[model samples]
Target: MPTIVVDVMPKAELLDPQGKAVAGALSRTGHAAISSVRIGKRFELTVDGPVDDELRASVQQIADEILSNSVIEDVVNIDFGDAEPAADASTEA
Candidate 1:
């Protein structure tokens, strides 16, 4: 099976009260290194076979139409499970 991972997060410019509250609680609990937190959603879709262009497009459409809100949220990342880490990417080698 092939899997698609979607991560959606609130826009940076928007204030996330839930995240703020969680951050404050963590700080109060002595986790001083935690400065902030932003809440988000993660969706994983497993298709029957290898992910192709058509599947990718369908997944993208599903993401845009049902998985996230475009008004105040952004799709931060989309990953095909079989993809290898890009050699030149700073986050992954």
Candidate 2:
């Protein structure tokens, strides 16, 4: 099976109360080195067949139109999931 991953995050200009709360807790727990945190969402779609161009486009549509709110959220990333999901570009070779 193949999988697709979508990452959605609140628009940067808006405040993320949940993320702020988590950051506060982390700071209180001695994670002082971390200054801030922004929480986001992850969606994984497992498919039975090959992940081709058509499927990728479809998933992009789903991410932009269905998985996120245009008023406050943005679809920040898309992963074809050919391998283990990397948290960010820094983790990839």
Candidate 3:
């Protein structure tokens, strides 16, 4: 089994009101040290099967196809978990 992590967010060119609201709160906290803040959603997917470049590519493709709309959306960051290789012992010595 392998785990896949995907992050989907609005493009920098797009307007993010929610992010703005959160950012505003930052200043209220008396933390002027922070100037800008962007909020986005994070998703974790667990897939059972082989963990290879092909699988990762497919996942990214899916994110672009259905998960996100490139028109006003952006998705380029993706992460994959460590998969344990199949175990087999050699009896021949």
Candidate 4:
């Protein structure tokens, strides 16, 4: 199985209220050195199949369709699994 990890964030063009809230709270708590903080989401998924181009596209589609809001959000990263399988299991080249 291949695992896909996604880091989603609000689009740079849009205003992020949650991020502003965090920044405000930080400044109030004496963290004035920090100017801003952008809030985002991370999602990890286990996909069953080889980590090929098709699988990568599918994972991207899933992220765009369900994991992120295209109107105001953007996907930052997608990482494939790195675990090595046991010798008994078949692997893709």
Candidate 5:
């Protein structure tokens, strides 16, 4: 099986309330030296066939159109996760 990993995050201009709360909690709990935290989402898709160009493109489209919201979020990354050889990857957003 092949797996594609998608990572989505809120746009830089927007505030992430959950991340902020976690950061505050960490600071309060004495996990010092942390300045900020921004949380994001990750989606893993396991596929049935070998990874190919068409499959990759479809995944990219899905990531951009379905997995993330263009208004508030960006599809930050797509990892091919052992389905293909590692290379320098392009960020989708």
Candidate 6:
């Protein structure tokens, strides 16, 4: 099975009230070193087979249409867990 991980977050320009409240609480609790926090959502999907281009497109569509709000939220990342890491081109030399 192949796993697709999607991370969704509010746009950087938008205010994050929950995150701000949490940060304030942390500071009050003596964790002042932490400057800020942004809350986000993560979705893990296990598909039947390898992640191909078609599947990738479908997943992107799903993320845009259902998993996230394009108005105020954005899909930060989509990761295919079964895919092999690309070789670092710089390391080839």
Best by lDDT, which number? 5
Alpha-carbon RMSD of each model:
4.7, 5.0, 10.7, 8.2, 2.2, 6.0
Query: Model 1 over residues 1-93: C-alpha lDDT tens digits?
Result: 767788888989999999999999999999999999999999988789778779877777777768888888877777877656223211211
lDDT of 4 by residue, 1-93 (tens): 656787788999888999999999999999999999999998989877678778777777877779988788877776666564223211122
Measured by TM-score, the strongest candidate is 5
lDDT by residue for model 3 (1-93), tens: 667766677889877888888779989988798887777767788898887778866776777777777786666466666553212211112
Q: List the residue pairs that clash in candidate 3.
A: none
- lDDT of all predictions, in order shown? 0.78, 0.81, 0.69, 0.76, 0.84, 0.81
Segments in model 2 whose C-alpha atoms lie over 4 Å from true places? 83-93
- Please list the residue runs of candidate 5 whose C-alpha ends up more than 4 Å from where it truly belongs after superposition: 83-93
State how far residue 29 of model 2 sits from its true place (Å): 1.2
Clashing residue pairs, backbone N/CA/C < 3 A, model 6 = none
User: Candidate 4's C-alpha lDDT?
Assistant: 0.76
User: Candidate 3: misplaced stretches above 4 Å?
Assistant: 83-93
Return whichever of 2 and 6 wins on lDDT.
Answer: 2
Candidate 6 overall lDDT versus native: 0.81
lDDT of 2: 0.81
Error of 2 at 5 (Å): 0.8
Instruction: Write one digit per residue (lDDT tens) for candidate 5, span 2-90.
Output: 77888889999999999999999999999999989999999999998988889888888898889988899987778987655435444
State the lDDT at 63 in candidate 6: 80
Q: What is the lDDT of residue 83 in candidate 6?
A: 51
Using all chains and alpha carbons, the TM-scores for the candidates as numbered come to 0.85, 0.84, 0.77, 0.76, 0.87, 0.84
Model 3 vs. true fold: TM: 0.77
> Judged by lDDT against the true structure, how good is candidate 5?
0.84
Order of models, best lDDT first = 5, 2, 6, 1, 4, 3
